[model samples]
Target: MVLNKIEQLLEKYENAETTLQEEQELKTYFSQDQIAPHLEVYRPLFAYYKASKHETFTKDIPLKTKNTNVYKWLTVAAVGVLMLGFYFNTSKHITTTDDDLGTIQDPELAYNEVVNTLELISKTLNKGTATVGYLQTYNQGIATVNYIHELEHTSNIIFKNNK
Candidate 1:
């Protein structure tokens, strides 16, 4: 009879469906030495619950006051400093003359300036390419001269071997 009741309470406990009274009953049952072999496994768990249930809060917590003069002043000062920094940053950009930012207002002039700059760059590149071409011709001439020198040197060795 007690085992049937214990089984029902154990089922309810695992499902978290037990009320405080039902939990207390289970805790009481486990606290006793007459626990069945299968139910012994749950004994320590209920014993811990029974032990923790007797504990009470010893200290009182203090609530906050409505007045916050110093704290409020500090918060306002922080916001003011942030606003001043933002204003200075933006104002520095705004105060500069149109000459500093330059001629986005004239599209044709910008286009002509870009074309002129590109032409100058390509002219310089062409001059460099022409110089590299002359170097390549000079390198080919030097290679041919070296090949002839090797052939003559080989022929001189053959002649000396014959003599």
Candidate 2:
């Protein structure tokens, strides 16, 4: 009768359908010295479970952390020094004299200066326009290739044999 009960409990345990009380009964039966001969294979597994239940962790964990506050303050101090140096350096070179204004008193001289500047800008723009001509030629070549592909597709459609 006990062997039949143990077999039923073992089947329920294998299918994960046994309650905690049924599991305790299985553990108690396996702990005894007279476990059935055919059930000896599960003895070691249950023994391991029993032994593992009493095991405890004994190692200490480290709690030391790095000092990043000093590095953060150093970065802030370096940026402050760089900004002060840049302000002082640029202030020393920014003194504007009357000659720096380039103001022409004569109207004719100002008119000639304006004409010369415009001519220079026109020549630079003409150089850029010359380069754009090559792009126009490339666009024409691509259009010719696309027209050829369309003609080939139309010809294939007209000459295609239908059975």
Candidate 3:
């Protein structure tokens, strides 16, 4: 009767359905001497569990963290560089006079300048429109492909109906 119950518990244990109490019963059964011949294979497994249960870590673990001294020195060096750059930047004299600012006093020269600027803007717009002309050709090619697909679909329907 005990052997039958042990077999049933072993089946459940193999399927991972055994409870903690059922597992303990199996462990105790396997730990005994003079078990059935076929059941002798599981003895070493239970013995291993029993031996491992008494094992412990003997060495001390170190909890030391990494040093950030290099990172701190890098941050200090970066701040020093920024301070030196600011010192040099502020020392330079940058005077912005009217002529340097490109302010025109003569009306005829100003009108001519406006016409030249408009001409440059128009040329840039014409270049953009030339690229758009390629897009228009691409759209026509896509429309042609779509028409070919419609013809193929109609031919397939007509041939399928004739068959």
Candidate 4:
């Protein structure tokens, strides 16, 4: 009689049609070592469910408060002190200087360097204009491809309408 009821319950459980009360009865029966020999395979599954049902994380987690503003203020104060020290140390060097800053000592050398820089800039501009001319060719090719795709699209539409 016991095995017959267990078989019926097992069928209902497999079909997910068993009620909570019937499920609890099945759990109670399977958790014991006195279960029938053939039903012993189901005991570990029920034991695992019973064991995991009571498990939970019980420790308290620490919460963050609004005391982070103190660290922000300290960081701002440290940066301000560093900037003030840098300004005072640099001001001494500026006040001690007697000659004009970065003035060219040799005028002919400065003029030669400027002329060489202008020549380099002119060469780079020529290279850029050559590349831009190639882009014109690329644009023409793209236009030709777009015309082909337009013809293909029209033919596809005509074929679809004929069907």
Best by TM-score: 1
Residue 82's lDDT within candidate 3 is: 100
Model 2 regions lying over 4 Å from their true place: 63-163
Model 1: worst 10 consecutive residues (lDDT sum): 97-106
lDDT of 4 by residue, 70-161 (tens): 89999999999999999999998888767757567799988988899999999999999987898888999999999999999999999999
The whole-model C-alpha lDDT of candidate 1 against the native structure comes to 0.91
lDDT per residue, candidate 2, 36-60, as tens digits? Answer: 9999988887788899999999898
RMSD of each: 15.1, 11.4, 10.3, 14.8
Number of the top candidate by lDDT? 2
Error of 2 at 58 (Å): 1.0
Lowest summed lDDT window (length 10), candidate 2 = 92-101
CA displacement after TM-score superposition, residue 116 of candidate 3 (Å): 36
Candidates' lDDT values, in order?
0.91, 0.92, 0.89, 0.90
Clashing residue pairs in candidate 2 are: none
Q: Given candidate 2, what's the lDDT at residue 59? A: 97
Write the number of the candidate with greater TM-score, choosing between 1 and 2.
1
How close is every model to the real structure, measured as TM-score?
0.47, 0.39, 0.42, 0.36
Clashing pairs in 4: none
